[model samples]
Target: MAKHHLDPQYLDPNYEPVVNRSGNTPFGDILAARMQRRTIMKGSVGAALAGLMGAGLAGCGSDDDDDRASSSGVASTELGFKAVPVSTENRVVVPEGYSAVAFLPWGTPITGAYPEYRPDGTNSGEDQEQQVGMHHDGMHFFPIDLKAGGNSSSEGLLVMNHEYINQNALHATGPSYVNGLRPADEVRKEIAAHGVSVVHIKRDSAGVWDLVHGSPFNRRITGNTEMDIRGPLRGYHKLVTKFSPDATETRGTLNNCSMGPTPWGTYLAAEENWHGYFANKGASQPREQVRHGVGSESRYDWELADSGADAYVRFDITPGSGSAADDYRNEANTYGFMVEIDPFNPQSKPQKRTALGRFGHEGVIFAPVREGEPVVCYSGDDSRFEYIYKFVSSQPYYAATAGGYLLDEGTLYVARFNDDGSGDWLSLDLEDPDFAAKVQAAMGTTVGDIVFEGFENQADVLLNTRLAADIAGATPMDRPEWGAIDPNTGEVYFTLTNNSQRTEDQVNAANPVANNQTGHIIRWQEAGNDHAATGFQWDIFVFAGTQGTETVVDGEAVVTLDDDNIFNSPDGLWFDYNGRLWIQTDGSDDAPYQNNMMLAANPETREIKRFFVGPTGCEVTGVVSTPDVRTLFVNIQHPAGNWPDASDPRPRDATVIVTRDDGGIIGA
Candidate 1:
């Protein structure tokens, strides 16, 4: 998204023209009706909602327990640490009793010869391949013992997504271009810097964490890594590229963002804002290109490399006079899906699971997995006016044998948030009768160059996911980002980052603010406590804005923000084993809260407090902790000022490890 006073060196790849033509109701209108009914009493909206919907928000599931397959059980739901005040300082600020240390920063070597980090940004493309990439986002800590079916927190593979790169910061001075062509080596380094990093990190006997360089588990899946194309859309004609003539595979995963960990011990890195890396120069682009915001120029111009190597030129994605196999027209089509990688297998090739409907996948969050039930996961498109989605595997999940293949066949559905606070899951399956009817009704209708009639098969629907969701009448949200599932309540919460383009007439109940620069969080409960259930009940969980701001409905204050909990752009959300909802922010540093931060919340009581504040000009995102919850790892991305080390003027994005001085549980 667009940050405040964003550096000219950093590009907001997510800044694309509004492509949603869904004429369906916006979430703000739904909130309007919901607020009207609850505002009858004179109390604040938070109190009214807690009194009215608190019980429903807490599902039939029992309190926190060890039922979760990933993280350990929580001691309590309350946020144990004291709230940390926001700061504009160029250093991380945590609670008084906590310690925060930077680790695995950009260009930190982990494999090969274990090259050391060069603060001057003098690392070569080859050097970057052996080190951590830039702009860390969503991440997870997979205990090494978990591979053997044991849970040991001392050692693990810390897998994280490098969302994007800062060309100015990646190079020593800046990029060099000759007559509009970029140096091949410069382009190569940029490509190497965009992807996922798997580092083998281990804690010493004294509880200090450090990378185990050259470990077998240390690997980097960069933009040049070859990955298998899997799922329903696999082998589809649209995926045919010059590199993957058979459409069974593609080279590289770009713009990786928030991630998800599978029950079978795998990492799913989401491809977000990938379209900005490719340009379609054709006079008239296809529906896939036009709808995805592929334009005449790319963000990094990798296609304009001086060498013009196939590896670099593929970023152009322009169709040639020859067949699809002769050009890179289908290159972008191979992106925008949840890529599954086995961190434990160094030789394993990441697989793009297309069964999870593709768009700008902010991240994927699985509902608690079951032995014989379908595996269900939810992902948001991470764009203004986009829709939330859920996927239910066609095959039952067997933990002993479950793998990415289970994600290959599934029914993907988009959410439709009704004005009545009720919702339905509209299946995108071409075989579904209801979806087929919706497609038929939308056929011949055009949005830009896209003819709805062209969506004749499941592959087409999956390829053009956003358009399909539009035809299905899914509610347009305010830039839906990360989502989390509460283990205690079975309730799902998602961050609806701001949508500044929404006009007064465009306001809906869920997104009540017209020019909502400050975003909000929305939570829902699956009907009958089943994630696969077609029906749901949703409500506004919290509105993020300046303190004293009130969301008024019919001359009555519905939601009034207090000073302590005020924040903006809730981007990352995760429910720890103890059921404390951790909310991370990625927004402008010009408000009641002057910097990006992470806050902990009691999901049941809806009490929120700031826990950690990031340095100046950085996004507080991507958080995970050890199985014991005693240690927490958070990512500070694209810092403007020298953080972690003031001696280095060039700021490097990094992971910060937080631990209590008493060695107690994180957030209690």
Candidate 2:
């Protein structure tokens, strides 16, 4: 609910993720300017609406009938989004009759006491690890009782990613003025709060979803939680850290963002913008940027301002007086991978599967696994013109398969777009002398200077993976973000979120556009539509734009955006069990569109419609649906942007459960 009003000078009056975080704007001037713009905007948008063709709205409910259409190989109804207004005062809104409940939220008990969250900010580091976290993102519910060995109880296992902290929103009343520092203890607690939480969920007879407190399945993996790494890169001497004596076990997972669920029912949580956590000294120098992902703009700038203490120093990633044999500059190399965690098994240590090529991993979507063929996963890097990646496990998959073990053993390949419509998956193996040379060359100075000051070991190369990608020549994309796989067709779809950083001249065959502010969603059909195929052909499925908006057109509107389903900044993506594609927007486009929203599309028809929109200034992201197609789970993240009044930041971060009031299937 707490959100900053859009500023006109720093940002265009369109739906967009770009915000002027410069904090230089005078609030008084902004209010005055906004008043003038509002009058002008209302007229322009009103006139624009008059010329546009109206798309009829379909009231929200089940999409079960869509399955029948797919079964007959017929294109079902085109999907569109209709605002589901469950609440008027900055809250989760759904269609009429459909209802929701908070599955889990910050400070909620896991195995600890069920303490009601207090606005006074009375949480502690030790308590944080066992409690729920802020900004819930990607999540999935595993019906243990449905599968052959799935849990038999009516209760289910919920695996959700806890993204970065909302320091302002946490503990109400904002910052506790302990001196000037944002209490290092608060920072420490935050680090421990961001990761994966596996909780037992149950739908009571009333159809309301609730956390099963004290359930044996409840557990939290924090930034400081112990874990191990496995793959060709495992224990390659690049992962060693002060804490990881074996170079395999890692201290924790940070900035846990979107997630992927495995064919074997395991959870895959991604680490996004992780490079910012390590404050590598001398970043102002251009040379430092080459070695690490951290540049000038990082969310975790705390490392820059904070004194090295309470483990904060470890994040400095600066050359230390202590031996590489002494400090943690080299330890950062362990993060930014698709960490696999088994929700059902409490004793299982989370595993970072290096086989999945890493970057700013948004999420990985699993294709139907075919026996004797590699199991494929789709990944996106949430960076401007970064890259979209895929990993095909060298091992074949079995039907009705789940993959914790096979995930550990596989080839992680980055994608390369060709001059033609075809593409190739580049292997990240050290076998390529060119790649090895380039990476080793870049590593020379970093090892000698900062990351591993005393001991820049091979581990530095692995953790500073974006640098490694550069050496490997991985293809950069147009702000690759979230991804989804077509269940009926097996084709993969990914969102290239808007990237203004790129110029028109830099555009090439893959990118093909300069300053592509309105992004596109791309899809590819693997050779033979086989998951293991190395060669694949791709096409721009749809250029997401409001109807009448000029966008990349692929002849057909395979994935077009329009008023019926008008949305922007395709970020969170998921295919429900029933095969309807759910698209959540981040960094929504300019004005007339008040807030970013969620949309549902029938892929066969390429028709999209707005399903729901969040309260003011919120991104509608993080979605996962139930297998029965009955319940749709979505995460409302950072509802309150940088609002000055933390106490009143109206839309608190939370996860929502959406189910049809008619008891029909979802996406129908």
Reference-based lDDT, each prediction: 0.83, 0.61
- Sum up the clashes in candidate 2: 47
What's the TM-score of each model vs. the native? 0.94, 0.79
Q: Stretches of candidate 1 above 4 Å error?
A: 1-14, 37-56, 59-75, 507-512, 549-560
> What digit string (tens of lDDT, one per residue) describes model 1 on residues 1-668?
12134334353534755777657677766556555433322222232232234444553456544443232234467776778887989899999899999998998888888888888888889999988999999999999999688877788999999988887788998777788788898989999988999999999999999988669999999999999999878889998988988999998998888999988999999998888889887788888877778888787788988998999999988889999999999999999999999999999999999989779999999999989999999999988888899999999999888988889898999999876668899999888998888888877887545666657578989999998888888888889999999877788899998887888886544444566677888888898899999999886677777765454433435556665677888999998766789999988798567989999987765678899999999999999988878889999999988877889868899999999999888887
**Where is model 2 more than 4 Å wrong at Cα?**
1-89, 146-154, 171-173, 176-182, 282-292, 295-310, 398-403, 432-474, 504-515, 550-562, 641-651
Error of 2 at 423 (Å): 1.9
For model 1, what is the alpha-carbon lDDT of residue 134? 92
Residue-by-residue lDDT tens digits, candidate 2, 1-668: 11233221112323223211112222112212212111112121100111011110111123465554533244334332244522224555666566766556566768666556554566676677778876677888788674566533346887888877666555445434334345566666777668888888887887777788678789889887788888755776655667765677777887777888787778899987676566556435322234334543334444433444735656655656765546665656677788988887898999988767556788888878766777778888776546667676767777555467677666566676653446777655565555556555655344322342221433443344444454455556656788887766677888877776655544433233455555666667777767667787665545555544422232221233344555556777777755678888776435535577777776655566667667556666788766556677787776654321245333356677777778756555
